[model samples]
Target: MSELKKIPADIAELSFEAALKELEQIVERLDSGQVDLDQSIEIYTRGSLLKQHCEDKLRSAQEKIDKIVNQNGTLGTEPANVE
Candidate 1:
């Protein structure tokens, strides 16, 4: 198995949608099996970073939403239901 490479610092600047789109593209490319082993490893590493970035974005958004819901208790919105 190939070792994972460090995530590029620029990846942090990408928006969640962009990262997700790139990750989806990576998945499709790997699924197609057209990529050479070396290229696949490189992309797979980057894809892992993108996946982590997307998850972090979602987690941040969820926290913000939960905070808003808590502050507006009158709305009676449950955080669990937001998901």
Candidate 2:
């Protein structure tokens, strides 16, 4: 691997879709076995970060949905008056 180049964008800054796309690309590259061990290690680290970011994004979305459901009384909390 030549000098283990840094990924240009911060993983946290990427939206969930972009991060997942990059992570998928990394998986493809690693699966192809074309990358050198050092490069693989570097990208693997980034992939893990992307995975965690994706998970965090999903968790946040779920929490928001749960709150909405609770407010609507779908999850057993008091329902907001609808009229």
Candidate 3:
């Protein structure tokens, strides 16, 4: 059996350029509709995984944001700072 190249682990830390290129290929494959049902399903699954990976990365980065920090031990309003 051959190794499947679309594993989330492979793309979880991929650079934006690499991930976007792979995502584009998946979209092209899906758009062409030339693949069999199984292949289509696999492609769709991979696309979803890639989408989730991107979203996870975004969320992880967003988590570091300090939202309305009670800085100086005072309950004051402050803009969230994304570090």
Candidate 4:
């Protein structure tokens, strides 16, 4: 019997680059059409999770960048007026 495949639950901990790399690999594999239907579904699910993780990491980084500011002639931080 084939073992059940599993997706990692710690995707949230992966860095932006790592998650993006995994997402790219999933895309390449799906594009190749080498996987069976079940495998395709599983991998597609994983890819979705990876995509969300990458997006969250990017948003967090953007927030940090927006927070950067200059105060009192010295480097400081303030909430950015992001629209």
Model 4: per-residue Cα lDDT over 1-83, one tens digit each = 65434435688778889899989999999999999999999999899888777766677876887666668888777765443
lDDT: the better of candidates 1 and 3: 1
Candidate number with greatest lDDT:
1
TM-scores for every predicted model = 0.78, 0.74, 0.59, 0.73
Compute the lDDT of residue 39 as modeled in candidate 3.
93
Model 1 misplacement above 4 A: 1-7, 70-77, 80-83
Error of 2 at 25 (Å): 0.2
Question: Whole-model lDDT, candidate 1?
Answer: 0.82
lDDT per residue for candidate 2 within 1-83, as digits (tens), equals 44433444687789989999999999999999999999999999889778888877787776666556653445643333332
The lDDT values for all models are 0.82, 0.78, 0.70, 0.79
Q: Report the C-alpha lDDT of model 1 over 1-83, residue by residue, as the tens digit.
A: 86545557788899989899999999999999999999999999889989888877888887777666654446443464433
Question: In angstroms, how far off is 80's CA in candidate 2?
Answer: 20
- How many clashes show up in model 4? 0
- TM-score order of candidates, best first? 1, 2, 4, 3
Rate residue 70 of model 3 by lDDT: 75
Candidate 3: global Cα-lDDT? 0.70
lDDT of 3 by residue, 2-78 (tens): 43445556777786557767778999998998999999998888787776666555555555443445769875555
TM-score of candidate 4 against the unseen true structure: 0.73
